[model samples]
Target: MNETQSYLTEVHCLECGHSMPYRPDLDFCEACNAAWLDARYDYSRAADLWRPGLPGRHVSLWRYRALLPPVPEEFRISMGEGNTPLIRATKLQASLGHPAIFIKDERQMPTNSFKDRQGSLAISVLKQRGVTECVLASTGNAAVAYAAYAACADIKLWVFLTSLVPPEKMREVALYGAEVVKVTGTYDEAKKIAANFARRRNLHLDRGAKAIAGKESMKTLAFEIAEQLARAQGNHTPWQAPDWYIQAVSGGIGPLGVLKGFTELYEMGLTDRIPKIGVIQTSGCAPMVRAMALDREQAEPVIPQSRIVVLSTGDPGLAYTLLYRAQKENGGAMLSVTDEEAFAAMRWLARTQGISVEPATAVAFAGLRKLVAGGTIRNEETVVVNCSGHTFPVEKHIMDDQMVLDMKLSQQAKSKEQGLTEALRRLEEQITSVLVIDDNPLDRLLVKRVLQSNKPYRVFEAGSGPEGLEVAETRAPDLIILDLNMPDMDGFTVLDRLKANPDTAAIPVVVVSAKELTPNEKSRLTGKIASIWQKGAFSANTLLQHLVKTIQTGTPSTAGSDVINALQTLDRSIHKIVIVDDTPADIRRLRRFLEARRKYQIFEANSGQEGLAVIKAQRPDLIILDLSMPDMDGLEVLDTIKLEPDLRRIPIIILSGEELSAEQWQRLDDETTDILPKEEITPETLASHVDRKLS
Candidate 1:
């Protein structure tokens, strides 16, 4: 039997279920334009290929090559990418009160990330296909891994990356001899350029999530986990899957592949049931988390702004589709953690479990902590957190002097008080109270779960307006997210009651409703509500931003001075300004004017779509929009911005060539700060409007 005979039985489209022959160019489904493909095999026969006591001395992922998409023996690439340590986190478990906790430390892999697993297979597949060159866009780890593996295969690799990527990462990728191109924009922008470059040069492209070989390679993590768990439990009986599988995700290919591995194991009668997967992401770039909260099938792309570079994928390609299905099929949820929380988790893991991880990996631990604190994960269940990467060249970016000092202060306090109890107290101190008033149980749960990801909020639910008011008065919540369609006292009544009460009046209220608001209702709630969100259109990320802002601005008088100080420290003092225009001369002039101010950080976007991405990433205080633009016009952009609860607060100054009609004036007046005709505007006039709005 040759390697070709042992190859995957077939490949099928994940979307349209269309079957096709394996080829590098056949990545997406022809029938449905879907980007994800599933490499299938005769599971019964594949299972027979593996036997007990196998993988004896094999330290690499090739131990499971029988199940993976086959490459010829001579073409295979291996660098000990698998068999990562699965350490029992006993001390961390004691702190969190979980019965059993394990860390699948993938940092031990070559290239110091799980991406090495993907690269090993991806580059091998490329080698098998006789491809000599390839192009890809990466945040950091993938570029390094692919470049390193490609170098070994003697393949020419062109790597495109965002300028914001850490200098150390860029140096490392370039060191691998790959031609690295740094784009002066966001990760999504870099990806677009890379895709175009690949097309123009006719180079093989490694589409992370869309690549079957890369996706299949991730299965090794799951396989190793299952096998190790069995060994740990004496290997007497069939392996039992962990109760929860947690990992920090960007493209979500890792989780998808892990889930597929569990499914295969179940089919082979090796595992009883698949674990509930927890997808963790940084709050700054969390489309997958937002989509899951909204119960959407696809994630809407947003500009990536996460400081954790490896997890800063603005568009996760086809991973969103696979993730949506995985969440629906399994009892799991997506969650997000702030950079602060992730840094704190990194410190905590190092102190408590002796595990050092990058911010991207630390995010999973942060999510796990939140889940345990929120009672989403039971104390008795066994859990595994995939520590996917470590901080090396970017160690300085993980924690600064202030963060280290804070950690030391915390440690000193822990020594004085009950260790675990003191830590839990500190964790609880960070939580803000949120009250959700909705008649529907599902709605309440949905919002509650969404807010759970933010990790700094304790959610209190009320089924009716009266109950809501009672909870708000009793709890004196930092924020109230109200739904307007409740029977016997709608959100309007509840808002009125809450505003009338002195105790709860100061608390910010965000009204969420499925029904359209009348003009009178809008006017009535204008000053009373902090923001109005339509139920179906509400986004978790947007809601979280509002919540964070509310917490920062509306610190309770009862809160301790220490708590107040901590909240204040979380605020970013710098103001961000974004300019969206196709005209380079106009953009240049505005940038020069803005830069002269000395206090503003300016971001430029050449198109409305790019502008939207910038807004999503930076959450700029102000925006300058050109009326006429290609792809998405200024009006369309304005409409889109107005619809977002977070972006709507930003002041927009419209630049138009033609004079506006009364309708246009009214529309602009309703949504924008001011509109300036191109002929009438000067730097001084623009600065005046900007100053007033910013002030």
Candidate 2:
């Protein structure tokens, strides 16, 4: 197949043989008007093309750019959104008496959900077609992601959701500059209203409503998992893909997408096996599960719906399609878990893996447990349970003390950031004192309990960031654990105070917060933060491990000698490198180059504010600033750099492949010393310029 137009050449209807025009704005089938639209590519032509170059593309869903629809390169927006970690579900396996359990961590995506991929692609298509506004009706995650990406693209977004939707989810969506409409009825009804509104306003509609395009967006997950498993098992045996694939089902786009990805790989002769997929649902409103059991083509909700609201999808048809497809193709089945079961599973995941998941995600874990207990799933088959959401309930749930201990033991093997030696040092250093700032009494108590596990550490608590800072000033502790959302001056302010003050700055502080952070959030928590461990990400043992690693270690391995040797081969003058674009391709290329050239450290910023922070902190000898950014313009950044006395001395290079006008050129010349157009500057060329500048 030709790599350029492989999986997406035309839009075809699943209901009818007729094809539709390839317009980004036109989502459904033109002929039958079927809502589910499949992308049809010239497969035979694509097959003629040789295997794609691995390690050649960005670490995103765009890595499969050849198979994606016709979105221009310039308009594609991404934020380290794809290639989520596929981890061993050791705790889940033990609970289910299954030896080979795994998890696909979609919760780690940019917007704390798997919807980042579709949202990015949707925004890209909209941008390509020059559409200025878009509206989406989502239960939760998808709405938040679309809002975030639209905000990034500087486009207007309207999110139609139900009043029953969680306030936290609403806050996240609204924070991203989206206009939210809280409908009075079910999500499906809200979606219907949104559709009508879109038509009435002539707003650009994302074809995901019927599920085909949204389903296709998830194909990358299946491809990646298959590839990862293949690499793990090697060529010596018959291909054994995952024995079962389990995930929470709402619109059911993700699971269906996974199935499609696997089908594509199998067709491409990459693998001959496919996993038996498991669809999990909350017992409160399990329309798809009931439909699947009855072998029904459509879905209808179970009555007396339980209030574990996150997985509240009453529309069974959307869910039924995924269940039906998975069962037919992979010999899969559906598992419905009760509200209590899901809540318990969430606690179990938290205690065991130090991962906080909401009820929607926990349903998968609960279902997997049920499968194991019933002996429906075998102990030997490799199973992957998808952790779809990171949002745990604000209120703490009750679990026996023994349960926590057992769970922790089950999850002891996972490696988060590596560095066993560093972990040992930190633990041994003896945290003689501890300080915590959180309003929740339970949270404070839990943190204290975790901190007190090591007798050498003494725990102290603060109600707010300001109080925490005051405590730090008076009684400097060995470490401070801070929370982001506080009543009086947030954690950022407290962090600033600590970093600014010589007394408290050196003490390494871990940020413990409930909020999901973006790349900008990660970047902004720079100076004094040793690590940002979300409230759910850290446990007593994990904290202990970190302390042992940090304080007791002799010297940490920055990189191995072999890595240093590879870096030394590069020009020494290139001590620093900067990535200018928000595009995934550029970020991937620059990151890969810097990774190989280990001596040259890498930094990035989505907007001008982030870029400036990197510049001030790293003080790189070279800089590459993006011409276009949402918050601050590239020209403005250039102006700022020229104005700063110290920053002006650093040599600047234009890394963008974009062309500058004669007038723009004149303006740039007046501002900077060098303009290394991306095309003109190879890695070697970049190295040469660095050599010239330093000499």
Candidate 3:
């Protein structure tokens, strides 16, 4: 086969099957109205083109040249990408009791990502056509890959990136001689800017997945994984497909190509079966997962909420439709893991398997664990997870202390200088709304002063957990600098409530406790907050530095919050119980009984009106309500709460002084609501009923 030769046939839309002859200028589906167009190959000549002289080749992605996108020999530049190791995760498999688990460590690729494959083909083809200038936008990895290849191809390239991207990533692109323009907006905004730049310069635009080279080059991963698995069994045995093939997704180009590769191989008598394609996503930006869960054919855009900025592609565009259909047909799961889980998995992989993966890769590992635990992936089945790249180190030295130029999108701002100043003023107004949740007056005042002295922060104080939650919603602060030792409600419980509420989950949190955290407390805080300071032990400067980092990066504080805020604070994995009654004796009795029986975090409201307020604030797992109240009746409270879509899911337990009401019984849910007579109820009876309802 010729080195630059390929069996390339056409470019077609994955959505509308709109086809055209292979053209370098082709990007979207054009008249077809889709965001992705993939390369098609003449499969009749596939065996001769793909299966020739396998024993001795370049040992890089170009080894299978005829199977890749075509470019002239002189333009086919490569830094020895591909040939990444597929290691058996023995410890991980054993820990989870799985038969076979493999990690396709794509971190070994030239630019330390699977993206190198895309760049090798994409940039080569562009270089062959004498393209001198290009532009693209990326969260991180793709920008680095494209920049490196463009540099090698001697093509000038410009990369637009979101401010949430790590400095390390920006520096990586800059080191490859690409002009890096950091935008203070979402990834989608960055793409628009890059597109505008490309149009103005008449430059080639490669918006990552929008290029056919991605589909063509990424298929090589599927090919290599098949070949490697067979060779590992020793005697050049037949390539066998694993039961599950998994990858962490952003724009979702990798899986599209991978699924294409396996399908072609199976048709061409290479592999026996197609693997179930699994795409993992961060919970903060899981449009695909959300769509699949609702059985939707297309994905809806989500606000980029997670701190893992690298995997922060909120809109997958038409790629979601393609992936969704493939997943539905192939019998796979699209799952999302929390930022906390992803970081924890990153740590786990490093400690147990000696694998240092970025939080994006960690999302895949976490999803694999979730699948295994959920029985979606059986232990007896084989699994292969793509460890896409090295973790985001977030080192300051990489950029030499140079922050990105904060791109302003406001139409009112004219000049760059005025725009930046206005942006900073607006950001200051938002970030300075720091909420200090501490019981100690002196400590709260000290923290308020420390924060204000540095940035003139407008601080709000809350002496208890409930007060803090109320203030958190009302003030809507950018960061919560809190102490853990509150007497009214422990700061931990407050942390749980803050996280559980969608209104506050995206807010960054920092711990500034006078008391040193215990092992249990440390474990709880590890992936939740950016860092915990021993209040007076650390210098104010150090605290501010950590605060700035923890508070998230973007145009405004709301663009997304700090990396340590990547910790995303605490999750409400524990159940909360709320007691509502006008009678103090009944409220105290029930609270005491539940507190002694189980360690459920209990909150109380003296009347029905106060109870409704408590439920809205707390979002408790279970509610104990007294039917008769002076302010509002229990049934009315139930009706009001049930009307709210967000609060309707919470279970309620009603305590009535007397019973014999069929109409009231008809209004309540059998599964979520249970009634009991106060005169007849006992601790044991209440415990049994509560346990059953909770179960």
Candidate 4:
């Protein structure tokens, strides 16, 4: 490498602080057993070389060549990834009662997302290393970006993705000539599969945040924001960081990289302060938000339920070690928004500001609204929200539902007879039809009640799989809620038959089952089923809310809209409860008792680790723990829970088989809601204690 190319001095492990030579294949630090690595630069020399008025005609990220990973100019791959517009959101600011609000419109970047910045740098670096093939796992946008950039660099790319990814995204990725593997599980699972594939093939794996080049490119966003803000203020300062920098995160690499950029500016005396960063996530699958709320250093993995596909990273690799510390040190806060709030914000932006964004991007705006309303953000502070990407081919999934609702409401408001007739015709043509296929009458009735409570839809019932198939063929319903435990035919057989027929294959199917699906059953439903709802894991209102959104968005796999309205209309409140015990009998007893009331959304875990993960993911209102487990006893779990400020507030009841001594009782008393003997735990007494504590 030449002198300028040698700007990258070394790569270091963020966890163990061990440094090593920069290599394309070295992803993890062996010394520390850490997956995250940071690229160190000769910043002293970089500061001297980079000045306010450096001569450069290029406006792309390469403008700061001294700071980015070194690559020969001839080998660099650039598609105008940086220097995107920074628009002042005057209307949004006025509406939110904030003084200054600006939008860093990353949607303007090539490939229509911030991923382009990383892709451009990453692909260029790989090319320099003479790497011919690479693989990665992405929800959507990143795949498209990498496919495009890698193709430009004449490199072979393999992409692994979950089946939940939108059809449009898959088409886009395939169109770029990249080999795609559609995994039959969540994004986290897809990542694992991709890692295994890379290992077996000995191919270069694009390790997202764990790769130095991947995160290094994202710092340009921060650099651009500072420079643009300074220019907007008519100031000649080299940098001007915002009072607050907000962005929605999945892996959290973007925000961490941006923070690093600001830190670089501060070291160079170009900026005075590091902006207080704000991270946003969907409430449905927000491990980072949960960790933040609990005041924990690490975020536990979750099975993500968010419909915002790009933000559904169940495990944010390196976030706890890198991004969490950045947030804490910078005096930042994390916030979460529901699908309803994000959709509302999406609609508001489109109507008022004429900015159409995907749900993931709108999440940041929703967070901004929440912060303003909660007084977490002052009115006078200058804030910048990252408008990361726009919704296009996926636009139908984001806007069509609201459009349909708006059209119906508009037609109803018209006074003309022609308009009324037209509205009636539209309703008749577009009315959603649902089919409930279950052997149990109670289950069918429950499905009907939930679907009907939200909006008017024609509901059809089938007592068996054969009858359900016949009705499905005849009625051509928009959706089907299938139960696995049928008398004559199981749900898997029904699903397979439906998929075999071209006529019925297009319709979406939601699996609602009480029985735990076997591996074979799960495999059969992988890409076939749109969603799976455990029978007692959700309340009727929650089901209704989800169904409405799924119908509206035309994405059966996505989470539903806000349930605040549904909650208001429901007769009884439903609270989530998690039971942690090694005994299956104990778990079944609690579940049986809780299910009888139909007021608790219950989850179960056999080990303390599993229980902790579930608690972090679900944020249950109450926890029931068995004190004497084989590994990681209840007391240890209780101590871990109590350490988290947010989780400590959740009431926990301990059920111990052994009688505790005076000191043990006192120690337990200080942290737990109550400790009752397992032998004394009757259904009635347990129910009473639960009701009182929850109340």
Candidate 5:
């Protein structure tokens, strides 16, 4: 193949088999809108892409550019993704009584997951095609991956994430500059809103299977595996194929890409045979596995019941039929593992191989273990397992404490404008203070430089553990960055003493050291430390990001604490009250009663919309809202107020004479809002409701 020429022929419908010349604008088949499009490459024009460990050849997924969608040098977007390590799982193989089990360690990917390949390819194509903005809905990793690549390409992106995804994952994408809109419903529901938003805004919508370039990116893993295997003997070694290829699926995109890759290898005379494929799913949302169990082409959409959000793609779409046919043709199997089993698999893999993978990836290993025990996978067969991605979400739990102002299920439509911006703004305003307790001057200076480089942090330093404790006790910084080796007093003693001391006990510590901890040391430090980083293993930027997170983990943030304090003193500190009513007479009456009850500063709005504007701008302590209003009604205003994180926290008293219907009562009661009858409203009746709500 020519260096710059792409052999990519066309994109075709998997169901209808209708093909069209590849176009960046087209996502679905023209003939069959329901079925997703799959990319086709004219393999006769293709040549060998494997030049492993060779100088001047790219080390990333872009190494196989001849087979991938072509992009100009200027438009190419990459973070050196792919080229992940494949380790022989010697311990796992022995335990399973299998001859060979190799982990295609996608944990080594740049974004710490295989989805980086998709991001790299998809963003490169989008940039090459001059597409400026795009939208995606992902349970977790994919959103982060795509956002990172899009950041590199300088493309605007909005990501819709499933609500169940750990808060850390949402924060990760936001860090990558993606506008994050979280769905309070299922993963599929988020997809609907995201796709609609993309169309409404006239931007690219990247959906699984339909995202042709992203789907095509998965095949590069097959290429790398082949190249790696060939290089093991010699770079010139003829193609050798594994007996089995297995992976966990969300939308079943990974295996579909692998199937296409291996088939192409066979057609191109690189591989002698295609491997039998195995796809795994979490039992909580295993539509394809369920369908495969009954020999059905597809299964009904499942409501995701899994706590493992990343693996919960409830409906597999065109992926079912395409993967099903491929599996059947290749003598493969589809299986599901429970969350418990996946968690156990995560522990097992880490215990045996020292590989900590996310629960989504563990689902495959769990299924692999089950398959081998059931004799579905023979002991003599060589199996390759795709450890697709995740360690980031599993390790971090800091997003909860951060200023993550998430929108509710009913608030998604309104979120497109205000939600993500609010979240990012709040994060920027959050300040964390750090104290460094390292005896090494260079290391202490390094840390101080990194922290100070970021912004607004009050960085304190101590040369020894005792001095550090003294400073920590007096200053009570938000977090401490400590080093293990110190003169006169060691870090462990400092940790014990700090935990024992009441004043400094709650301060989180991040240990940065050159020393490698043993099992006993690791166990000792497990609950004591927020995180550990080896001195040279991390960059200054990475250390800064993690240090900030360490300050936030496990405790309510500084901002959250301030909010709590503010809420506690509302009755005494807050003086502003907004009376939202259409009638000037009613507003005057309510204001007079409120002012007499307490020394409150009264604000007035003539209409519901006007009231919302005033309430938002003034951020009143309480709201006295009239139900009956012209134009925007009280219900609409209530919805808008409750949808906003800042506005929702304020106390609302519905002082209206209007007889509310049963449904309106339900909605109001659900919000737990206080209601006072306008007809019965006197100084005493209104005061009781206002006092109770404010108090």
Candidate 6:
């Protein structure tokens, strides 16, 4: 069979069996519109009509052209999205008593999700059909994935999401440059509005299962898993399918496609038995699970609130279709899991297997646990759980909680000897002196001693704001320690005076008192006070915790083979780091390194073309550059770097290794490349320059 005849001959309604010609712009079954249509194929005229022979084809889902709808190859956008790894669960097997347990890690895909698999295909088809602008209604991963691929394809995308969507996912969608609309109601409501807008605008509606291409894209997971199983058995054993294929069914396209893939393999005589597909749903939104249990023909819509951000679907059309087809084709059933159960399952997977899964993915394992405990699933059955998202959210919350606890625990761990040692260390390190302005001498002394021991601090006594500023001007201390209560001028007055004074404006301040500051007070203090510590509420340990966090946040790590490291180090001291280089590779390497660190805030400019403009906007602390760069040379950057009065104090570290003559060395000494290097770089050398300049 020629490639032209592959993919589809027609689209047939599942309910009425009425066939219609394939159209890229078609959203649903033209006749029924009620039932989702399945793509029909002329099986007799297929090319290389064998399943096992497919290993030679492309690794993506598009490899199955015999099953997907026709779309131009040029329009297909991919980031190597398919062929995910199938991981074995040895620990889960031992505990759950399942002889063989595995997980399909979909997080490995582009955008860290399997959603890309469907998004790439859907957007590709949309582009092919001449749809320039489109709208999507999703609360979580789908929104993120769709927005990104749409951007990649240069298609205008409008995404509608409810306020219930997670803030992080919302930021992701926005970051992808998609126009986002936040609705006050549930995702279903937003979806309804999106549908109406699509109809009014004559825009294309792209659901995971709306097009054959999207659905067929998911088949890559099944084919990959099948090949993996065959390889695992040493090619001697006949390839056997999974006993239980467990996956979370929200829109249900993923699970349904798996069954379709199995049917395809069976038609090719690759397998004789179909896997028992278990449809898992969250208890808060178990429309399909409820329908299946009652043996209803269809599901009624219900707003779900357990996790409105992720599982925000009110309708379960796809889930109902899965239940109807998978249950009938293979002996299977639906299971529902509560939010609590889902969380527990997710945590278990993370702790035991080190696989951090999204709550939706966790629902599948939760269902499997229910089935196992209830003796519904046999111990011998092989189970596969599809882990949908990365475990970053759960881990972030866990880290935040631990940080809070560390502050509390450090108080218990504090000792007088440790305090004295810290005080001596601070004194030797020449950390800036701070004045404690309070009427109570005892409270002042206690805070003084705490800071002196735990941080680089010097204690100064002040009866009021006037006295504090008087000492601050005379001593020009690097920081101020203040109390809200004072005899003459309160700590707030001292803070205001210190900040108003140009000489001491940059000095950091710490508020020390027994009073609990309100949110308004904290906001008012702003840059003047680094933090507020309650007299008894914050111990030396808590101060240390704050210091460590501040330090980690303040300083960029000098690690990596990137040009941005030097600039990033400077950025921590201030707002930005500037690198003036000519080579794209040097700029790219540095930017990538700095971006990866997260600790270092770095920005770059390749030439002198807009070097000064970028510097003005970024306001960098230090500039590291090659002496020669296109449009702007090192001398030009150096001259411009020091020309601005606001940028005069900022240092320049020339990162060049070209062999220099005596004249060149003399020129470097007089100009910005004062710390010029002629050999390879090292962290210690860079650190020395940063410390010498910033300290």
Most TM-score-accurate candidate:
5
Per lDDT, the best of the predicted structures is: 4
User: TM-scores for all candidates?
Assistant: 0.56, 0.54, 0.58, 0.56, 0.59, 0.55
2 against 5, candidate with superior TM-score: 5
Worst 10 residues of 6 by lDDT: 400-409
Per-residue lDDT over 1-695 for candidate 3, one digit per residue giving the tens place of the 0 to 100 score: 55567888887886688888877657678767665777877776876544532666447887666667677677887899998998999989877788789999999888888988988888988887788888888988988898899998988877888988877788777767676777787887677667766775577888566677878788888888888877765535446677889998988889888888888777777777788988999999999999999999979998799898888888898888878888777788899999999999999988888898888999999999999989999877889999976734546654432223345566677874465456545433433477888888888888777776766455777777788898787557788877888888887888888888998987878777766566687677654564566666666665665565445431011011121211212335546778899997787678667756634656677788878877886677888989988889899999898899998878888899987478987887556788888987788888887887677
How does each model score on lDDT?
0.76, 0.67, 0.77, 0.78, 0.76, 0.66
Candidates sorted on TM-score, descending: 5, 3, 4, 1, 6, 2
Tens digits of per-residue lDDT, candidate 4, 478-574, equal 8888899898999989999988988899888888888776666666776676667778777787677557655654443122222222211122356
lDDT of 6 by residue, 1-695 (tens): 45533547788776677889988777677777754767777654443464435546456766666767777678777777777778888888777877777887888877767777788888888888878888887767877788788988988777777767665666567556665556556667667656665665677766656557667677666766766666664564334567778888777777777778776766656766677888888888888888888787688887786772476576867557656766876888688888999999989988988888878788888888888778777887767777778523423322221111000112232773454344323323432455566778887777666665755444567666786787676555555667887767777777888888897777666666766556666556754555566666544655544433333333222211222222223223344567666675675555555444444455555577555655666566666677766676777666666667888667777767577778767766753345546355455565566445544
User: What is candidate 1's lDDT per residue for 1-695, written digit by digit as tens?
Assistant: 34345547778887789887766446777678677788888777766655453545756887787778877778887776889988889999888988788988888888888889999999998988889999988888888899889999989888877777776777677666676666656677667667766876577777887778877988888888888887776767535578789999987888988888888888887778788899999999999999889998878898877788778887775688777887788788789999999999999999998888888899999999999889888878778888866525634333221111011113444443344344334334333578889999999898887777767356777889998887777556788888988889988888888899899899988767787767687666755765566676646665565556556555211111112111112235546678889997887777777756745656667798988887787677888899899889888899999899988989988999887878877778764567888877677887898888788
Candidate 5 residues lying further than 4 Å off, grouped into runs, are: 32-35, 47-58, 233-236, 389-405, 410-695
> Could you tell me how far off, in angstroms, the CA of residue 61 lies in candidate 4 after the best superposition?
1.0
Candidate 4 residue spans exceeding 4 A from truth: 1-6, 391-695
Q: How displaced is residue 35 in candidate 1, in Å?
A: 3.4
- Candidate 3: C-alpha RMSD after superposition: 25.5
Off by over 4 Å in 3: 28-35, 48-53, 234-236, 391-404, 411-695
RMSD of each: 24.7, 22.3, 25.5, 23.1, 18.2, 21.6
Error of 4 at 59 (Å): 2.4
Error of 6 at 624 (Å): 63
Between candidates 2 and 6, the lDDT winner: 2
Of the two candidates 5 and 6, the one with more favorable lDDT, higher being better, is: 5
